[model samples]
Target chain A: MLSEFDLIKQYFARPAAARAQADARIGLGIGDDCALLNPSPGMQMAISSDMLVSGRHFFPDADPTMLGHKCLAVNLSDLAAMGAKPLAFTLALSLPEAKAEWLQPFSAGLLALADQHNCTLIGGDTTKGPLNICITIFGEIPPGQALRRDAAQVGDDIWVSGTLGDARLALAGYWKEHPELLRMDEAQHRQAALRMHRPTPRIELGIALRGIAHAALDISDGLMGDLGHILERSGVGACLDVDALPAGPILGTQIQDIRRRYTLAGGDDYEICFTAPAAKRAEVLAAGAASNTAVTRIGSIEAGSAVRLVDAGGQPVELQLQSFDHFTSA
Target chain B: MLSEFDLIKQYFARPAAARAQADARIGLGIGDDCALLNPSPGMQMAISSDMLVSGRHFFPDADPTMLGHKCLAVNLSDLAAMGAKPLAFTLALSLPEAKAEWLQPFSAGLLALADQHNCTLIGGDTTKGPLNICITIFGEIPPGQALRRDAAQVGDDIWVSGTLGDARLALAGYWKEHPELLRMDEAQHRQAALRMHRPTPRIELGIALRGIAHAALDISDGLMGDLGHILERSGVGACLDVDALPAGPILGTQIQDIRRRYTLAGGDDYEICFTAPAAKRAEVLAAGAASNTAVTRIGSIEAGSAVRLVDAGGQPVELQLQSFDHFTSA
Candidate 1:
């Protein structure tokens, strides 16, 4: 069996020259008790952590490459939500055993996404246990310019980036939980599964919306639940047009009821749900155009503290769509 | 069963005012997409991550409070080794279930240590899975002042703080693998177990040795194995005075052979093994005194790349002791 040190050295440790070219903010990369980072002057470090367990977060025999991509992708999504530039990250991994076959693709997937965003792997710990991948990501952003959840204002336009519900559609298809309801072709299944396996963090769009959007967050635990966090923290409410939400291409072909449920409460989307002044609609569209991402205005911030769901004609729509809760709602 | 949101709000999330008083570097704490941190100007951030699994790192039925303390203690030990001041930490916890009976004391132990070090728990993630605790800690240090592993120079005096081998002694007693070779009373058992469960981080002593010690690291994986890291990185050797090693008070009563094996190769000591200039021996002692930790000179950096152990009369001592390796050792 390979020792822990050899495992890290073989798979994760980057060459010195490659690491130096990855990011200059890294004062010390690895092979130390702690990795040192120097945040740029006038910038605040944005930090977030996420843990992906074997059975709960992914399949027991899930593709190692996709698993690696998803783990870092989730964390980087948090940084994107903060409108921060990715600088570095640390990975704490617990594996049952050290296998070169598994680690080779895993590191490739992880480092590929890391390199795409110019994020360096600083330092971390590895131990023997049931498989768990925990990542703490660090990014830099100018102080007071962060797109905070509490910054959403009354009468702001609610916008979402890209499509939603494809990841959840793939999950539902995989589990066969709604076999009677979900009917997908082979290509649709592959495309939806890809959405779940490889999420694109909206880094460029977040950076583009820095001063344009009022507040924003990544939609991971469904739009309704995640947007509720922004509302709860901002002490506001929203009036959402249920029929106007942008659904994934495959999901758009589903039945109207299924489209409504999946688009409203589907988790793992990784899209940005943000709010901006109604007057900045053109600017918001330009920002989305600049980032080359689709932006759709689906709702508006309201005065009261209750989220009202309305149909296309503005009539209230009553539905019970539960969000994904790790503990209570399986 | 509580939802994930409810569990976080009930157990881990601290009151706003309490969090504000804990750390000023935290610009935005929990309830956001990511926490924001402002490093003091000219101070570099030292980051480290540690993961602790239930059965592998601790007993399945281990006391949750002590388990919590040990998990954070090990990560803080890394910051201490780098001579950095603790600022904030993020935790990602995967649990089988959320039970207040287990969480109450666990949070108590974890938060107590954080408060003692004036460190804040900025943010974290919680989910359902096999129990695992991962913490990523952030600290601050001046540029070029960190006690690095590659800074040891030839003829520098090597020192060890406090004592060693008590944690391993407790493990040996519990496993009963060497019952014929070890004996201990109940009081001695409790003392040894405390060392295993709640090892001090030596943070103050590390900060005090800022400019005095050339190279330093925490003694988590035994003195020999950890010291070997410094030797490999610095391209130097060490001549250790084996008989002069400071054994734990309880281990001091053991026989010579048992003492040698436990003191030299025992893991989980959490003491600081540092190398300082021979001319600064008096200053080193004063540094330890000011930090109120016992420091003992036990070796010297040599020209070659091997660790040589000798007795009081300079006679070589031959012994075969293996350091703890997570993958290769049982």
Candidate 2:
């Protein structure tokens, strides 16, 4: 079995990716207890952290490789929500026992995703426990350009990228329970698992939307509950058009129902949810195009104080709204 | 009892400490789900992480408050070993169940230490599991002045600070077993426990020794074992004067007779061990004095292949050193 040190050197350590961006002054990365990063003058850096516990966030017996990818991906999502460009990250791994096979594939998956996103695994601690991985990501953004959660304004249009409910369906063990999900062969199952394993961090899209987004947040808490943060913080109300939502094709009829609230209140979509003025709609779409990311207008902001969703019939759709609270258990 | 949100607001949020020499730009400190840092131009930021798990790093019933303190302290120790100044930190907290009383004091202790050191608890994740606390710390230094374990050279002087072996002894509950060990004072028992609880991170002392020290590391796994890390990495050997080691006063004549061996191999001191040239000995002492942090010379770097302990009689100390391994239990 390869030791932790060997695992890191084989997988996590990589040469400079694209020369550390001119603005990013990373003098040293990988091979040390810590990575060093230098940002340009007057630019503010953002840091965020998330912990994924086995059995709590993923299946206890889930693939270790996927666990590693998901850990870094979730942390990158937090940085994206703040319009921060990825720089580096740290991991703290807790496991019940050390298994060489698990560690090898896990490190490979983590390092691959990290390289793709231009994030370096700077430092971490490994200890024995009930399999918990905590990741803290560091990123940089120009001063004053960060899109805050409290900046949403009345009359702003809400937008989300990509289709929702796919990760949710995948989490339901759909691919594991039904062999039809394997229609595209082993590669297809792997791809679907990849989406569930390593969702892309929309950092480029976020950086492009810096000035365009009035209020922005990651779609980790479903749409309604997360959008509620914008409404509550901005002291405004929202009118979510159920029909305009970008639910995946799996939810054919319920797409416009507004009551089946997985996409609305189910968590872990990791998509960016932003609000902008109707006049800047074209600009927002252009920004997404420039970043090669998608954008779909799903709702509009209003002057009232509550977030209300309207079904296809233009009638208020009153659905029980909640979020995936870390402290509150199922 | 306050909810998680309220607890975070009441304790973790604080103003960033502005430093002229520190390169880590912590703009937004301890609010939202992440902290914001803006690095100074031409300066690089160093980061490190450490995780402490129940029944692994500490006793399962360890005080929650002290656990928080030690978690952050160990990570800061890494920054200190690298000659970096800590700017901010993120904590990933996992618990078997939600207990307001436990979390409140735990957060308070963590925030107290962070505020004292000018580092803020920026962001963290809280979940349900066997208790584990992982802290990731951000520190800053000049682009290339970081004292690293791989930089030690032969013919340099070795130094350590404070004393060692209290934590290891306390681990066996030996101090509690013998009333005479603590001068029979009940408070002494608590003091020993406190040492195991809140370890002081040697940041100031480390930063002060910046230019003088060639290589440095924290004495986490004992003087001999941790110092061996530097020698092994630097491809040098070390000869320690076992009689010159610094040991706590708790041990009696019997333990003191072999204090050199235990101090050489005991772990969890959190003190720093560094190498410097004998020519700059006065300057190093003056620097430690200026900061009011004691520095004691212990041994010397030698042109050899491995670490060795020499007694007063010029004979090698015969003992098998045992250090804690994060991956496996003995």
Model 1: lDDT of residue A116: 86
Give Cα-based local distance difference scores for all models: 0.90, 0.74
Model 1 fnat? 0.90
Error of 2 at B14 (Å): 6.4
Off by over 4 Å in 1: A15-17, B15-17
TM-score of every candidate: 0.98, 0.90
**Per-residue alpha-carbon lDDT of candidate 1 for residues B218-273, written as tens digits (9 for 90 to 100):** 98889999999999999999999999999898888888888888889999999999
lDDT of 1 by residue, A1-330 (tens): 889889888888864226845566889887889999988987999999999999888898989999889999999999989999898999899999988989999998999998888888888988888999999999999988899999899999999999999998998888776778887988998899898999999999889999989999999999999999999989999999999999998898888888988899999999999999999999999999998999999999998788999999999999898988888866
lDDT of 2 by residue, A122-229 (tens): 667776678888998888788887777778888899999776655655554443544333222344445445556667778888888988888888887678877877
Taking the tens digit of each residue's C-alpha lDDT, what string does model 2 give over B31-53? 44356777656666888888888
Say which candidate scores most in DockQ: 1
In candidate 2, which residue ranges exceed 4 Å CA deviation?
A1-7, A14-24, A31-33, A172-195, A253-259, B1-7, B14-24, B31-34, B174-189, B252-258
